[model samples]
Target: MESDKIETESLLENLCVGLPTIALKADIPTPKWNTLNPYFGAEDITEIVDWPEFNYNTIIHRYGGILNSKKIDCVDFSAPWMHTEVWHKSQLDTRLDELVRPHIIRTLRAAFEELEPQTQQLNLNPVTFGHGTTAITIGLFWPDTSFTTVAEGYAQGKNRAPGVLGISPKWSSEWRHSKFSNDQHHFQYNQTLAELNFYMDGHGARCGYVLTDAELVVVKRLDTNGRLAVSAPIPWKTGGNGQLSVRLGLWYLGMLAAEEENWAL
Candidate 1:
């Protein structure tokens, strides 16, 4: 299993190394994309990855609208969810349904189309999103994941201890002292972490995300240890390379979702 993991990681990186060229070759339409470096804000997440394959330095100048921050303008800035921070908890579902989920789904669809079945060696399915309530967004990957599990997992979290983003469950305040070590005080200690973990577990998903409208966090289940490789809150409305960082990151995550268990941890 250890040797397989090593080979899988190597293959994963090698396979992903050509994604930029693949994305570049996909002439979906016109000159509508560009490149940017990924921002790594989470210090606790080990094996930090810089997706240089998707960088324009290697491939063509743009990523062919699949990762275009300026070209594909699906976000409605006038909507309430359009702001940097989604202040209204009730409308969180609207943002996911109307904006975030659709964009990422398209990204995955575009990504999957670029790969051959022999290259991917996995059956891809229609990616979608749904949940019982709007407290969190749940991804429905290939083979159709259940929404009840999402609701139940989220309910378990709420039942254990109510938490508001940034206030509880190891947000910015706790992150100041958060450590990478697997101890009692690891990132998985709180109720919110439990919710995120169980939510992915229910879907049998290895790749997931936590998008609070203010900032985005990428969560990857590493192993059976219950510890996740989660990114720090990256401002999605605008990032270091403008909005491209979050989109590219999310696109990479979408690729991981399609790969499912085949993806490297």
Candidate 2:
């Protein structure tokens, strides 16, 4: 754990602090991080990273130089403008493919199954890149699950970062019966809803993310209008990119190996 902690610190400093310093250093040969940055000064980048003596780090000092060495073919630090975007994108995607996909799939799958069967639709829903995708809400509706998810929010000024919001437990017998739902799990949804409220109140109009892995199970408000229509659950394995199949294969392989290993043990 201690080693893990050190590695985590190193990673944070390297990615957040060191890399930006190197970028600035390359851009401005003056060697001062603050002067190097075209947009914000070096101090601002340091404040964001919260790193001390960032410029003194060997990794930080040698970033551009090491990449400039003709020895490395794939990494082209030669182009001042393209190095950060091109190489950084390729490197991150490669690493995430190797590391993040498995853990992400496993964690989401377990959370989905532990929930009710219909809730499993969350896993099947196509993941979109904007807003509320990350801020997930798990609401309880007695014997069922129901929720309302916000899509995205507009950034403050121009193109900064948009705030995302979510609303769960839109209305349930559990909520209506009591002024405040006492169930711990149900209340957890309420807590999230409150936080989202603050975010929206501070920011602007919060939009709803296109519902994924969800069917409108209960529609109390629009009783006279009609019943809620739920899109048929998309098969977990069939999709345009075939990512679901790949994830399923990985999960199955993991289970088979675990079972075999258990027997041997």
Candidate 3:
């Protein structure tokens, strides 16, 4: 259990590394949040928090003075990150959690702290399920619940990352079908076939993203061949859509990852 506890200093260190300017600020008063993190951040699946931000709004911004006292560019979310708003609002509703929760569990189970592009989603499976005459594709669906805000998604498990992944319906179906078949060989024996869905819960991770100073990458979880498909890094700070600040994108991602439990199913 001690090993399972993410060291606060290290977790803070990881978060601070390449961290966007404002991922930690939210409604909570900074002093109050800093006090609670080391405890709640340790909770596992047993705690079963229905909402993820309850912990993070209280945790993420405690990285000390630089993020605390300093003001970076006087960031504005509604203006620049307005693109961070959820798209395709109808897809993965509350109805699919049972089907999707497994994906989130897999991510938690397979979680490690690596921030490089792991692989690519060449298979692009699309999952189409029917509810009345309306049909939704898993990869194309939206996370109406997972991430209401980006800050919540970024604080997701502090595993650190780079890239956005959009899983196709076929890939989604494949992930559902594979469902851990021969999964043991993946982690223990270095034979990975799972696409590593990170913090997937409600929005099915459709719009999930990862970023750093140089690049903005959309990360998709692919199940067809156990490889990750990372979108080409779109420069974040000084390229087209430069207004898409790393802070806002991360905040958007924080919400996606926050919907961790609120996500998959």
Candidate 4:
């Protein structure tokens, strides 16, 4: 037991050192569709003329209209369009597709690469979440074999089921019941850490922890609607102080893992 505790503490210290500090900036600009001359007809332009600036949600919504609306004819559209039996499909302008999507993807890829050690060190694949102009989603990766261990560690931390580690299990349950009970796919990944932060923020408490073989996973919930989030693993080290502090979620998971060896004993 003594050796196990020492090992856990040392691991915690390593994680504290591994966690990278990120500089948050609002840089990605929303896509502006109205600027396209022939793609948007005069009437379509008039509808969005009052919009002060481009927004991802707005652009996506309008783009969906172009794809789904029977009223929109490809004659006036500049981009290449294909006529499907159900709807008109067109490739987005290179300015919108390449400039906007690739930029966000690259930015996120770079940030994650910087924060997470190469998979050779941890044997995990990074998975991203969230949607919008900003890279506002947490990325998590773990080896398949370690899932139960991590889940159990999280359960031990709270002396309860692992469900509580979720952003808002109750709210998620309610939402599932009200809207997604019949749709299994809908319930899969709809909940975001940002939503959890919104509901729990004012209570002076938040849950931010998940067990990892590497000792810790640092996650940040940046927005209420789950538009922005970040996460990365903190690898373990030996003979180091475990006096490091972390956000609520990661702290809880770390506490659980600190007692992990005891679970086997």
Candidate 5:
């Protein structure tokens, strides 16, 4: 475990070199959406597309440099929302895919090509909901499995095998009524939730990234209303007890992996 600290610290330092420093600003007001204009207007598209840092070359260059030549594929687990049944049955005929698919695709491609030039494919799983809990569960509970296996399993809606860490909002609710609700496992569950809350609150609605040999899956957080939460790239702590530092997107995945090991044995 001590070696893990040394290695992650070295990795964090290397990744942070020459990277832009951005801190999450606290108590910033979330932007209000105009329901009268149900669709994103020109200004909305311009704001995202014209953002230079999120452009193709810059994102690819940054993550590629961090991985140091590791071949990578990029996956988006949020694609399911594109074909959501409610949107298909809506009176306005509004399609969520029409709103942001282009921008999302562009960013995903930039990350894919930059991370793994040899693999030119971007995998899209249209079945997985990919909320924060699902993403963290995959990373923490199944660290040894390849990314492809996990992605495909989620896409097919397979239950995780036994003796693995599995907790969802519903599971949390059920546990609250069970006898073991006040026990040690419950304490760990609360700890995990606290950490997630810290990530979201402290980082101000940023996305999560799980980097693996086979793929890098980006997990975007949505507000209670199912709208995309505004996010910025901020530096955040990766290890519990505030030990290692990394960019916010990478930090959640690293934290899950670290804690999984920390709690083992």
Candidate 6:
């Protein structure tokens, strides 16, 4: 059974390596239309897509518009999910209040407090005010200083489960205090990292950090039609640097949240 799992993983690894080019080639449209005949010869390639008729621009507008609508934009900015430090909390405070009312905040907080007692009340710190597209270290727990090479530690670290990004988890021995030895050379911890900064301009977007926490464990599960879902894992690390890192761009964290909700339903 274990060997079969290894063989299956090896096949998937190879497939993943080739998927980018395959997807690029497959997405190109051709003018080939099928007929009732079992076989047919080549014909002049016609216009593949009627841009005016279908109007993909309108489609983008439709999708983006719906996502942009005030009705759908009913996310509570003050919610614990948006929890940043007190200083940084201001960036979201005034703007989020524009969308959500005090009553909503109270309701959400009440619910969260019941589910997780560790949730701290809003302190509205000012330290979290900043903006940019760069890497932010969410949190770091078990620091391993044993591995000789970062590549080795990275490979072992990635063996845990579903990886973040396509990089397949590389080690950062350069960040280590010393050489790595045991698998401890590869620490196991949780982080609430973000690569997206703000939504749009100042009107739609605000200058603030998305409130988050330390030691957020994310677990991936398979769904229908090759989709995936991620769920929160139980925090394992004890004391360490709990931070929130965000970059400016499209993010997959939203997808993880959606999957978690879908799985819950």
TM-scores of the models, in the order given: 0.47, 0.20, 0.24, 0.20, 0.21, 0.16
- Residue 264 in model 5: lDDT: 15
lDDT of 6: 0.20
Query: How well is each residue in 1-265 modelled by candidate 6, as lDDT tens digits?
Result: 4453222211111111110000112232332211112121111111111113112233234223222221211222344443332222233333233322232323223323332333223221111111221112123311111101112232232111111211102212121223442233222111111111101111111111112112122322222111222222212122111211111001112211112123121
What number of backbone clashes does candidate 6 have, counting pairs of residues 3 or more apart or in separate chains?
A: 19
Best by TM-score: 1
lDDT of each: 0.37, 0.23, 0.28, 0.25, 0.27, 0.20
Ranking under TM-score, best-scoring first? Answer: 1, 3, 5, 4, 2, 6
Model 5 segments more than 4 A misplaced: 1-109, 118-129, 132-154, 157-247, 251-265
The list of candidate 1 runs beyond 4 A from truth reads 1-88, 113-126, 129-170, 173-189, 239-244, 260-265
Using lDDT as the yardstick, the better of models 1 and 6 is: 1
How far residue 32's Cα lies from its native spot in candidate 6, in Å, is 62
Per-residue lDDT of model 5, residues 1-265, tens digit only: 3453322232223333222112222332333111122221212211111112332234334443544443223322334344333311121112212322232333333334443443323222222122233323422222211111133453332222111111122113222223564464344333332333234322233333322111122333344222222222222223222222222233223222222122111
Off by over 4 Å in 2: 1-180, 208-265
Candidate topping lDDT? 1
The regions of model 6 sitting more than 4 angstroms off are 1-181, 187-250, 259-265
Where is the poorest 10-residue window by lDDT in model 4? 84-93
Q: What tens digits encode model 3's per-residue C-alpha lDDT throughout 12-126?
A: 2222223222222234232321112221111211111112232223333522222233222211122354223221212222212222223322222222112113212221111
TM-score, prediction 4: 0.20
Candidate ranking under lDDT, highest first, comes to 1, 3, 5, 4, 2, 6
- TM for candidate 6 is 0.16
